[model samples]
Target: MPVGHFPLQDKIVVITGGGSGICFSFAQLALTSGARGILICDLQLTPAAQDLINQTPDEVHFMKCDVTDWNDLEAIPPKVEEAFGKGQVGDVWIAGAGVFEPKWSSFIYDEEKEGGYKAMRINAEHPIKLTRIAMRSAISVNKPCAVLIVSSGAGITGQYAAALYCATKHAVVGFTKSMGQADIDENCKIVCILPGMVSTPLWTGRSDAVASQFSYTDEVCITPEDVAQGMKEMIEEEKYPGGSLMSIAKGKLRNVLESKLAFANDGSEIYKQFESKCYAPIREIWNGERGTKLS
Candidate 1:
């Protein structure tokens, strides 16, 4: 039987990167659970996300946005107010948009290029900025809010080939834990979802990417819907306190103890395979034996 009561009932939700993957899945579930309003911000809406807007023209809105751009992020507050009405803060805010260190914005390729690593900016810095924006918006209206930070298993366990990706995820895990202190006065609860091997475009799209080096076959990966359900439970379930790091893996959800997170995949063969994949190219780049390719 379907649960009758939805915690998100009548809530206003805002999700960044609600285009094609986990964020889009959560947006669908959020609407089904009775969210009164939802704003999806992404560079462009995928056909699926666009179709959702078509089906629920009244409750959902899409705004083209680049999460890494501060001006674009600064526009969200006004957009939220415009969509839902003045003085209304989103009840649930999800920093759900991220990348997996693609070549164009890679740490290995662009770590020292003009600005810092784009992956860090998108995966780590964007969430930090958005969280601050969200908290301030909630505080201004004296409203209680829930913020979900989309982290990863990589955040806890180290990945040798994707050191920068690992570092970006780690940054947010620590940031979310520290933000729990902010809830003491403002009632702005924050939590993180550290999903394992999700079958999303961010990880699965590039066949030659570092993420593909891992054993993320269908049997080993969970669907975006699976992670989305975990996200819903985290928001509605009382047991999940502020700063909780919930791990969603193979359709099972567990609360992660930060101290014990390192053991998540300690003896896994997939981890070993992942560690071995790009040692040569990475070493070549570091030792200046090969030219850096930034395209």
Candidate 2:
């Protein structure tokens, strides 16, 4: 395994929602890092093509896609292979497509079924479904790959009125953690990212709408570029093993502390030593001897 290596050289990368925002930024960086081709899938593609076609020099291809639609996602692998001209499955996929509700994000809403379901599907189920398919293809071909899940800080923190959004994000974080462990069981890598308040189209709106409660000073919102750079760093570094949990916010990057870390006492010994003493044995029993007991 090429750990801590910039390995995108001459690889085909597929990114859902790569048309704009953080994923777009990531694509630009990936191209500069030597990725041979990038296929961008998004419901809104014309703007990106128009903008990126003449604006950027990268080899960018556009695909019109609704990430919420399983059929659209199922067709991606073959399309990518056809474009890149290799039996190689996607070298990397960024599950970056997402949605946000405006006034209907609340549980108190009356007629907002579409908003709720769409947001949930786009933000949570879509990525999970796409990642499962990608994992299957990679394992079937015995190819190594990486998947970056763009979860949000709301996955950890709650949104006041946006209950459904928060629920979707929380589900994403849990699924990401599970998938990351699965990557360990397999040979691939799953990197989960939790970005704090970011400047993106998700927050665009009319001035007439009853002002957003989530707004902060310009300094509070991290640039999409910064988040993209953080993701690039994570993908480049081999130290970020499978099941890596990271947060990008306030123009800074750091690892999201696992639950076990909180239980460790402040002392001279390393945290891993405390982890070994406290949870290792029970984990073994639970995962091995105890879990094997059936009936």
Candidate maximizing TM-score:
1
**Residue-wise C-alpha lDDT for candidate 1, range 113-174, written one tens digit per residue:** 64667788889999999987887676566566788999998888997777888999999998
Please list all clashing residue pairs in model 2, or write none if there are none.
3-238, 4-238
lDDT of 2 by residue, 91-206 (tens): 78899998665454445454566644667788899888877776666666666677888988888888667677788888877876655544444456777788987777766533
All models: lDDT? 0.80, 0.72
Question: What stretches of model 2 exceed 4 Å from their correct place?
Answer: 1-6, 46-49, 54-58, 104-106, 113-116, 205-211, 259-295
Q: Give all TM-scores, in the order shown.
A: 0.82, 0.79
Badly placed stretches (over 4 Å) of model 1 are 1-6, 207-211, 258-295
lDDT value, candidate 1, whole model? 0.80
Deviation of model 2 at 14, angstroms: 0.9
